[model samples]
Target: MALELIKGNTAVAEAAMRAGLVSYFGYPITPQTELLEHLSARMPELGRAFVQAESELGAINMVYGAACTGLRTMTSSSSPGVSLMQEGISYISGTELPAVIVDVVRGGPGLGNIAPSQADYTQIVHGGGHGEYHLIVLAPASVQEAVDLTGMAFDLAEKYRMVVCLLLDGFLGQMMEPVVMPDFQPVRTTPPEWAVGSPDSKERVVLTSINIDPPNQEQFNVKMMTRWEEVEKNEVRYKGYYLDDAEYVVIGYGTAGRIALTAVRAAREQGHKIGLLRPISLSPFPTRAVDELADRVKGFLVVEMSNGQMLDDVVSIAARRVPVDFYGRMGGMVPYPDEIANAIIEMIQGEHDVNADGRAKWLAKMRELVGTGE
Candidate 1:
């Protein structure tokens, strides 16, 4: 395995091309434009179709059309641009299309900035697009993880007959790091019988979410829930470091997870029993794994680039089982490991400020600042 220094965004594009993706439809957006640019320039040599769509919506619709043909396809954009594609994403999810969407998240709510942010946690992980559906969301912390997981996204999307998204942020996408490319192997995709261009196709297939009849819509929703349950069971991925004899666990994902790992190492040197729990899969959110950790650890500390969106998942899993502390930086601010280490030390020494209501009052103050009212 030869390693080369590459930015995370470029790695994703390279992986897609190497993995036999012949169709690329995307619109230019900050932090992720390099990916589209990379594919646009390189894909033509492979005789692949690369289009710079007029808008995010147009780009996703192109993906929809190509995916309906049962060929490997992909699209990418940042948070705001991804928001534009949600309606199309929901339709794609409803029809069980096999496609990959890369979301290099920036600060949000509206054209926030061109900085790294984990603010899309609630949107991507909680089914951002309106519908009774979920997209398999993978969060990668490094350039290597970004490339490797983008390849996995395509595989999982084909296997599940659904959409899969690689969720990273500007930091991971823009920062250069050493990445080893996987061996070039052909992508093997077995399209379902219901797919439009399948061999046995004898009639046109309609892919839409519009089931106007109430009872039929209810039935479809139930079926979707069943699939989600299976996803929860089999698809959760996380990495546990230094957890063997730890008293506190630090939970994070994407770039924040890497920071948390550094903090864990620092705490170990200081003789603090802190470990790191890094979620690789964000949607099928490794909740049960987190709950299991509660049995051993005294508490869980949730850290993120946003104001505790992922922390909510941690709190849900840790409820009544163990104490969960939350720390976050908002508006696209990134935190250093020293800050995380300090927070862990404070928690270990029982130095966190708890309100009279026994709630972490800082959480309430943070929500107030973010105006989330949580």
Candidate 2:
């Protein structure tokens, strides 16, 4: 495979096509509009279904409809647009329809900015919509990763019969990097038996999120939970760097993780014992790996582009056994590697009281940085 300089969004779009994506429906949103644009030209030329939806709501529902027919389908949008698609996402989850959603997150509380940010960490990973469902969220840190994971998203979605979100920040989406595209797979023309229209089927197939019967719905929920557990057990993915003898660790994902890697390398070169734990699968979250490292490391620092959204997960996995600190730059601010290195150094040199007081102090310091404390 020849390497080509490709933008992250373009890489993702092309990767989806190679993965046999038969249908694509999306509305343009910044940092992600190029993905839809690429698909707009390519999908039509390939005779695949492509639609420039009226709105995000329409796009997601279109995904739902296509997915019901057992076609590999996907939709992409930015943060605000993603918010509008939550209801449809929830519905897709409830029905156990397989589909891919790419969230090229920008700064946001509500239409905050068009720059890169990981603010949607909690929203996409922790369930953006009303439900007990979980999205198999994959956070790619590079353009190559964006390409690889976008291709994998289709397989995972079908394998688990669940929604898969390729969560990337705007920086990753817009940035260009050398990527070797994956080889194409042949598209499946035969619809699965569970699909709405099966030519060999003698009976009609209906897909719906609603189950009026209380006991039946309860049973359905149990089945969903069981499947989720299976996903958690088998699908957790992450990358650990310099953990063998490191006294301090930094945790992050996506663009934040990519930045943290640079910081970790620099800190290592400076004789500061720092390492990185980067989660590739955000939902399963590499909990076991974190727990194992927690026993070895002196303390942990969570770096993100949001107000410690992923920090909560890191803390929980650490289980208060080690002191955990958080540093983030919200609303489109990207942290420099030096700044993150400094944060890690401070964490290592600061108090080691994993007690309530130490935790409180750490929170206080973080709050001060964000100007949320008095």
Candidate 3:
């Protein structure tokens, strides 16, 4: 291919299909509904399994059963819908099955509007489901990036035998961008040896999360911890801009990071030694990379569409080695580049230390600009 203009949701769906997605089960929800709608028609057209389950709860279980066969399986939904699927997500994790979950986040604590939000940061990145489990979370800022990540998600899920979430907000899901689609991959129809059915195996294979004895459960948990160490070592990902000689750094992810880039560029033209670090993987968060910046930069500015979710992560990583300021918008609000640029400038001019009240400062700014957003 040639590059084609497409919406983010549709691009991800098509890319997953190309990546040999054999089964999809989901309930429609705003922002992400387009993804389900696209797959509903296409999956069956290709002789793959596609089901519009009765509810989000039902949809996730369908994905779980399909995944037991060790084929490429997935489901997508927005914030509220994802909340409904939490138990199923935990079950898939407990069973150590591979599944890709696309979470196009929307505003919410409960039934919030269909507007874009990053509020689900702690929810998804920190494991919204019950019990001890690790999820590889990938956040993409553009339609092209979302498409690229979609294929990668399936591969990673199987590689780790765990759930992988492709997380982005409504803005990215509904926005249009040009993308170079990936090539179609060979779909696997037969079950893996560890899965429910495998004729070659002499003994019957059983798959379940249940470990009745306490010592047995502890042993299983220890194995998961060892696997997570491998994931942390190999999967940390991030992107940097103008960092070589920069003195001040900004940290963010997904759409927030993309917007921060525009602000950083503007600051560059103004002779400010500022840069941006956008984390592509939220879980195994670029911890060491950020720690290095804490030593290298004069300060760090944390930005987000949520009220300081990722900011807390940066703050903990930086550990007051450098003063960290924050800027954010909540309830589906998105901060403008100029607002972030202004934050960068304030960060440079002020004598604030690591103990500075970032929320208070951000609230002050918000108070002054309440009626000014365009």
Instruction: Score each candidate by Cα lDDT.
Output: 0.85, 0.91, 0.92
Question: Which of the two, 1 or 2, has more lDDT?
Answer: 2
lDDT of 3: 0.92
Compute the lDDT for candidate 1.
Answer: 0.85
Cα error, candidate 1, residue 55 (Å)? 0.6
Q: Model 2, residue 297: what's the lDDT?
A: 86
Best by TM-score: 3
Ranking by TM-score: 3, 2, 1
Better candidate number, 1 or 3, judged by lDDT: 3
For residue 2, model 2's alpha carbon misses the true position, in angstroms, by: 0.8
Ranking of candidates on lDDT, top first:
3, 2, 1
C-alpha RMSD by candidate, in order: 3.0, 1.8, 2.0
In model 3, the runs with Cα more than 4 Å from the true position are 367-374
